[model samples]
Target: MTAPPPEQRPDRPRRCFVIGPIGNSYAAHGSPERAAYEHHLEVFEEVISPACEKFGITALRADGIASPGDINEQICRHVIESDLVVADLSGGNPNVMYELGLRHLWGLPVIHIGEDGQLPFDIASVRTIKYQRTRTSLAGTRRRIESALAAGIQDGFELLTPARVLRAIQPGAGPAPERPPARPPGREGGGDLPGLLDDCASVEDGLDGVTGQLAAISGAIETVGTLAERSGAEALDLLQAGAPAIARLAAVSRLADALRAPAGELHALTRDFSARTAALDSGMRTALGLVEAAGPEERDEGNADFLDQLVSLDEEVRAALSRLAALSASAGRMHLLSRHLREPVRDLSGALRQLRSAVTCMGGWAAAARGLLPAAAG
Candidate 1:
């Protein structure tokens, strides 16, 4: 359970809004810049959407949303309000740059994405997920983004979280943008991330319960898989021994019922536990962040103990999340295996039906033969 990066992750609104060039007002219609703009759209639809869906995040585009009021107001709201914002830096679209700057001023994390060799020099130092339009490149990028989203990794921050922006909107503005509100005394910081950390810490006491339930689900899934495999094998043996159709069907029926019980229970349990784990990560990611520590003289023994508690709690939360993810994966595999196990049972049932029909036909033939023989003797 290594400590997560020292950064507070805000409670994501569970939505990601795209900020990029969707227009060619500056570039010619058939020019390379226009082509690049179209390519970005493709990347969003093909690559980003899948990854977002996998982690339960909704992806929205600037133009896709509608509002009765000003469109700029809507865009600004999403820029400030969305849990996550992905900015496309290709061609250095002024609108994108402006919006990206605004998000940074608010000190929220924004994922920068662009084409290789196309970012402006100023932002070149910033970490950007560059990609080509090729199928392979897009596919790999999707995987990378999904992994980052799951782990709460940011592409860039701080530099993006600029201290100020021009408030006057004029050349040589009177002064820089207003500073964000100061954090409260004795608190980690302000904004969504700090508050979210506090919210998550509140749930620390229930972590033990979550871990126990996850363990139970994992065990149940394993047990179900084993039972299904054994039952299927036994049914196969009966088939080879030429057992009565009724006996084979009855045996397989019992196995099918047994398999369903655990699979269903584990599936539901896994779903519920996964949600809790995600919530825990949401808070721990922020709480474990590297806020400014007070000087030695400012610190007391009580402060030291509190810090230790936070470190320990963070470690526990990370471990629990990792375990929960693995358990969920195991449960998924078990669900699939259970379904596979029932395939043979179904086949056996069909075979039994045919066998019963064959036996009935043979009895009818024998009865007719006996009647014909008596008639011939007469």
Candidate 2:
């Protein structure tokens, strides 16, 4: 008799929720603490919120809920309902930590994040992500959070760290074989699954590098906007100098106009990528679910129903892989476009440099002319 193919187990879908102190409660007791609370709100909205949206995870900010009685109870309800909880430990707020503890007790998957300086001693043993609280830090933090959330959703509570969780879900993972260990590029010892994990790690690293470049482009756009504003303010001064200097003034005007056009385009591209990246990250987490359910022992079953489900999941992974490839291609195009714009921007910068030198020379000549006039009058 032919041996039956192994029965595949069903993978469970993941649903995640975010929990933390909000409103006036996030800070310490006094007025001085109020500013800290505001800062937390800002980061939550600008950084964490976008990150959650990208990962297809529901983020519940406690501050938004109006019903007042027993806030902890409400937090507990959310945690119970969620497949995972991500807690922000910045400001060391007791309430958030307490909620986090409650989730931990339930043995649900939880990801902890804190500002670089605000990590609590109690969570020292637990894996936590450290993030900088500044606007400059938002994109990097968002990527890390997405990666962490993906890992957590895939592996459950026991696999808190990304590297550990990644190792577990990687195809062909098994206990290390006894041998004289050859060190692999991204693993402790040479192994097939570890090698695959290294490839995945490299992909994540490339994603991070792209994210950083996008952030730098965003920052540059902001800086250019500020420069354009300053140039506008200086326009009247330039006109007062002489009508003959109109060409230089016009050059500044054109540069500002040119900067605005490409900046807007780049901004749109970045926003689209941010949204797509979040979706891709979420989809990857869902794919990991299939791997989790396809445990070695489960494959012993030859049930047709389980095999059908496995086929469905395989199809889903194929779809996601295609989407990921498209996203990568779109990102590559955007990067190339950004690079293309840099040459024009450089030329504009040169024009501005020449204009500035002319303005300085005119100022020196004007001062000399005034000095000579005074001597002649005397």
Candidate 3:
């Protein structure tokens, strides 16, 4: 019964996959475990469902899929493809953690919530909305969730999980390529090579955007630094005519404020690129499976051309990664130049982490694709 935010609807329908511990159905009808299962269902229907409804998002849990198909594959697809994921970490369910980890690697939007006392120590730093099962508490929880979802939909979700941190620190290591799922039955015709190529092109365009944003941000910082240097007595007299120290402090504040927008834009752009590369990696892996399934005899010149373009795309990614790293390092030096700027640097930090993940994703896909070309020709 929480009041919804102002009417805001996405251009297209959005899907949210919910992950949590669905208690054992095999337990006795009157058993505690079975009762727990029923409780979770009630939570879903009353709390989660209504929250998603206000935003026009369709929410589904793993067991809610109507189609009769491979449930594991379906869950994986939802984790990778859904516009958002809500992970319930109560009791630190292993399945929920695994799905959450996957969603983190893709660097898409996710919201974490859990029972007040049950969150794991490992993810203790993550911002999770905690709630009790009391009717009053649950209502408050729903309102909190509505606010989080509204911000995510309007502004964008910025998550910094351990997986993302590890990738950012370890530049040479990309996420280990997931084993390609078995090509579904009747998929023998082939994979969408052209679609894969288009995805790569889109990534290229995105990199260009990131590069431009970085340049603009760097210029902004330089201008701020120049203005701050002029905060001495002579310059202060000509400008604000205030104490030199006060003028310098004011200028430092302006520098940090100036960084927020460009840094935010870069973060948003790189986050989108990160998701695209993750999907491209998955698609390329699927394409490899189809190629392998077709036998090398079916390989043709078109396959070779795609592989060549992929190699070029990989080089571009590597170059962009180098540039982003260098710029991030420069930003760090600038932050040191003005010690009060750390707060505003948070967005730049997120942007760097996302860019690193995107580069790693594209690199993994390229490595997998490289093997396919020679194998196909043979």
Candidate 4:
């Protein structure tokens, strides 16, 4: 008989939340700044994304999450929840630093990286991968990150209990939030078979609710990704065009206004999405454990009544899990690309810079014309 697959030690689903710049639109398209930006994107996509896929990990970022919630708060939630964090500190981006700081507070391992010579001194003491954001060099970076992730998995590291960090700080400075109390088996409904079955039934009902929530979250994420995609090519168009090329400032302004972040929608979707995924994960573990444990020590492809009973339930569980995985994969991609959505709105800053430069150039020309006029008058 084919031996039953080993009763595997259950582990947390690995989630790698990435942190980095989404390439500044204001940078000249062919300039080094643009190259670096693209390089960062490539590393996350080609290098990091594939590496995560290899390990069945979910890698996400802060932008364009279809979850309806505040962006900052969503980011904070990921910072708290992610199994591993991969931060690109290129050019000492303040936002990366801030999120990295938040990750540190959890006392979990964070893999820090930056463009060589670009990481700030304050964090220099922390071990970091000083990388050259180029195709040739990214293999090394990917290896380092994957190695760190493998290490994290071995440790089964994820969220931290606040008690450890809380004690180190000033007394009464800040209180850690209380965790919901877990119920004991015998304490609930006198622990009889019928009562236990009722508890199981209630859990089954809750899983149904969580499943519906996940479905809504998936739809919302798809919508947010759609909106973010619309902003990219248009922003690139504006960035590549110069002052003389912009015949109508009003048209550009209108475009920028239209691209104004679908921030609220994204936050709502992600907030619900993230929470539901967590709940679904918990439910999945419980359900799978129950089934596996109910079967013989070495489960077989048998025609027993109990095995027959689980056939439909097993199919249902697998179907729900597949959808959940799909949602996470899509959300991870959306998270990576969503940050770039803001760049179109941010082009207003770039536009102002261009206008200032043009105005200064015109002033210089006017001065020259004035000098010529005085000479002609003389």
Winning candidate number (TM-score): 3
Question: Stretches of candidate 3 above 4 Å error?
Answer: 1-13, 166-378
Local distance difference test scores for all models: 0.55, 0.48, 0.64, 0.50
Q: What TM-score against the true fold does each predicted structure earn?
A: 0.39, 0.36, 0.43, 0.39
lDDT of 2 at 128: 76
Per-residue lDDT tens digits for candidate 4, residues 1-378, read 111121322264367788887776479999977876777778788777777777898787676367998786687677656666788877766567656655554444467777797887766766777777567778887787777667766764433322233223333344222321122223333333232123246445654564454455445445444544554455466657752434334444443344444334434443553454344333333333233322242222221222232333334334433443443343344333334334442332332233233233323323323332323336
Error of 4 at 29 (Å): 1.9
TM-score of 3: 0.43
Model 2: lDDT of residue 212: 57
lDDT per residue as tens, model 3, 177-224: 222212223433456533222323544465455445445534544443
lDDT of 1 by residue, 1-378 (tens): 111122433444378898987855367888987876677778888878788888678899877886578786688788866767888888776567767765664555577888777787767877788877689988888887776676554433332423322121333323222233223233443334343223334544545555475467546646755775686688789989999878876775676676556655655664555555544442332222211112233333333443444444344434434443443444344334445445433432332333233233323323323322323336
RMSD of each: 25.1, 24.6, 19.3, 25.2
Which of the numbered candidates is closest to the native, going by highest lDDT?
Answer: 3
- Candidate 2: which pairs clash? 6-299, 7-299, 7-301, 54-278
> Model 3 — which ten-residue stretch has the worst lDDT?
1-10
Q: List the residue pairs that clash in candidate 1.
A: 6-290, 7-289, 8-286
